[model samples]
Target: MSKKVAVLVAGSWGTALASVLAANQLDVIMWTRGEDQATEINNKHTNQRFLPDAELSPRIQATTDMAKAVEGASAVLIVAPSSAMRSVAHQLKAHYKPEMLIIHATKGFETESLNRMSTVISEELECEEGRVVVLSGPSHAEEVVKRCPTTVVVASLDKASAEAAQGLFMNAYFRVYTNRDMIGVELAGAFKNIIALGAGMSDGLNFGDNAKAALLTRGLAEITRIGVEMGANPLTFSGLAGIGDLVVTATSQHSRNWRAGSLLGKGQKLDDVLNSMGMVVEGIRTTQAAHFISQKYGVQMPIADQLYHVLFQERQPRDAVEALMGRDPKTEMEVMTLETWEQWHS
Candidate 1:
């Protein structure tokens, strides 16, 4: 029998990943809360709302029932938004099997606890932390659904689990790599969204590529700094989950975070920007969490700090840019502590 993989939602990213599994000749069952959406995918083989231009594989199926989705499945991929991850994991607990592989592609921290997605999943599923694998990188759903060439990393402390996830998702068009730095991967994925929002704001304010380039460069520095302090591998920040994902999210028109920041740069109010987005901009909430996290870690994240002020304190976007530019002069590498430098060099 073909391997069966269960996807816990029919959102764009989830649907795209299901299609990738189906392309590998796996039977993919996608679960959604909306009956109409499930019916549409089952009948038309297309999730028009999330993935409009692509035709879904016949091997892919959809159901509204949670148990039905996970029944006898070899793997389950949870792609719910960060805010919904805990509840969705709880819903899957009754049906989840210990032996079945659990993978998640959600990006962002829990707002209240600032926990990574894998941590949240393990806590909710009552599984070992190593049992929860995180799949993340530069790929966007809009492109993935179309079989565009993409690469991503799956990270778990358990190498076998990470390799299993890699095998489950790997195909000609979709390449998956394995990494053990789950902390770095998850943090890099979540933190890059904030920088992406800042990049979009730069463009929206008519700032040229020079500004965007600078943001991307300095953004990686601060992200790596905090990730290292939080027990992540510094080198991981230079990999796919770091500079690679950062570049794509910061510049791509498909990024919802970038779009939200663009709107803010264009002078839209927070409420109005969010309402017009019609999607959860992860960066908005991540900014809130980053603000608290920077304080907690005593890490100076000037860009994230400026972004937090713009996002929460209602500071004007241009003024925020001015503040960033007018900060006290310092060396470019000052963000990386001497200990971090020694660790990286020695």
Candidate 2:
């Protein structure tokens, strides 16, 4: 029998990943909340709403039942939106087995508790937190489903599980890498969206390459600063999940966060921008979470601070940009304190 994998939810990213698994000749089952979506995928092998141009593989199956999706599966990949992660994980509780390789491709944090997606999964599943793996990088769903060459990282505290996940997803078009710094990977993945939104807003404001480049550069610096403070390995931020994701999300038109930020920069209201996107722009919510995280940790995140104001407080996008530019002059290389340098190097 072929290796069996269960993918939760039928979002664009989930469907795209299922397609990858099907390409690997795995017996893949996808669970969706909507009966219509499941029926459509089962019959038409197409997820029109999410991936309109791509046709799915016949090897991939869809079901509305969560238990049916995970039953006898070797691995369960949870791809629910961050906002619904807790509820989705809870639904899997009765069907989830301890031995199953649990992996999540979801990005962003739980707003209420400010917990990472892996933490949320472990809490709901009652499994060791180290057992959960996070798959993330610059790969976009639209491109991935098209078999466009893409690379991603899977990180976990358990090296064996990380390698297992890497083996399952690696392919000719989709490359997978393993990292032991799960915290750094998850943080980099979650935090980059905020900078992407900022980049889009910069573009929408008609700021040229110079402004956007500065945002990307300083954005990575602040992100690394916070990630290191949160017990993440500093070097991880310089890798795929870090600068790699930031560059793609910040520059690509395919990024929903970037699109959302563009609208905001063009003077659209937050509610209007979100209502228009028709998808969960993770950066919007992640911005809110980052606001709280920055306050809690007392880390200075100027870009995130400006974004929080622009998105929530009705600060004009231009004004936000002005505030960022008008800040007191400071050295660019002072991101990490001497203490952090010693801890990381020593």
Candidate 3:
């Protein structure tokens, strides 16, 4: 018998993951927050607003009822925006089952608590340490549903959790790797969005490709620095969740972060840009969360700091870039390794 997997997402990415699971022959039930969306999925077998071109599997059901969605689910994939995670968890509390393995596919931090998606799920659901696994990488929702070749990481503190998650999503085109560093995985996934914005700004400025390349490279450096300080394995940043996701989000037109950054760079107001998209541009919220994390942990995330100032404080994007470029010159890794080492020593 196939395992039943409940996917909590109402957006394109959520639909894509559900499609992948259902294609793999799992009993997939996708839960959207709205009855209209659920109706569309259940009746039309297509999420018109999100994945218009792709057809969902008949095996895949949709529901707006949280209880029905969670019931009898052997595994649950949390793919809602970072902001909604806590509230969703609260709703799931009464129906929580010990056998359910929760996989977090969302990639943002809670601005209010600066907690990673997995951390928020653990706290809100009272999950055991290793029960919550995070799935992250360079996979884009648009491409994944098409069965384009994609690779992702399944990270958890427990080897078994990672292995179990790997078993759920691994396929010929969809490859899954396992890692033991949950902190690095989650941090790398969340922080890369902030950097992708910086890259997007470079594009909006019409700066040459050289500038975008520099921004992406340096942004990874910053991400690794903060991730290392927060007890993440620095090496993980070199892998899929860190540099890989950054490259994809920063360069691709499909990235909401890059799109938002492009608008900001073009001098559009943040609110205006977000209003135009009609979907959650997660980087906006993640920027605030990363900004707080940087200040709280004393991590020198120049890109995040500058992006935060630009997005929230109304600083000009050009001015933010100028300020960053004009900063006192030092060895690129000068402050990075030292701070990480110091944190380790302390």
Model 2: per-residue lDDT, tens digit, 268-289?
Answer: 8989988998989999889999
Clashing pairs counted in every model: 0, 0, 0
Worst ten in a row by lDDT for model 3: 336-345
The sequence of per-residue lDDT tens digits that candidate 1 reaches over residues 87-122 is 999999999889999999998999999999988999
Winner by lDDT between candidate 3 and candidate 2: 2
Return the lDDT, model 2, position 31.
95
Candidate 2: regions farther than 4 A off: none
lDDT of each: 0.93, 0.94, 0.88
lDDT of 2 at 41: 94
Error of 3 at 212 (Å): 0.9
Candidate whose lDDT is highest: 2
TM-score of each: 0.98, 0.99, 0.96
Ranking of all candidate structures by their lDDT, best first: 2, 1, 3
Error of 3 at 311 (Å): 0.5
TM-score of 2: 0.99
Better of 1 and 3 by TM-score: 1
Taking the tens digit of each residue's C-alpha lDDT, what string does model 3 give over 1-346? 2379998876888888888888789998888778898888888888888877788889789898889888899899989888899998878888888778889889898887787888788888897767799999998899998999999999999898899999999999999999999999998988898988888888999997999988888888888887887889888999998888888999999998999999999999998999998888888998898888888888788888999999999999999989999999898658756656775557
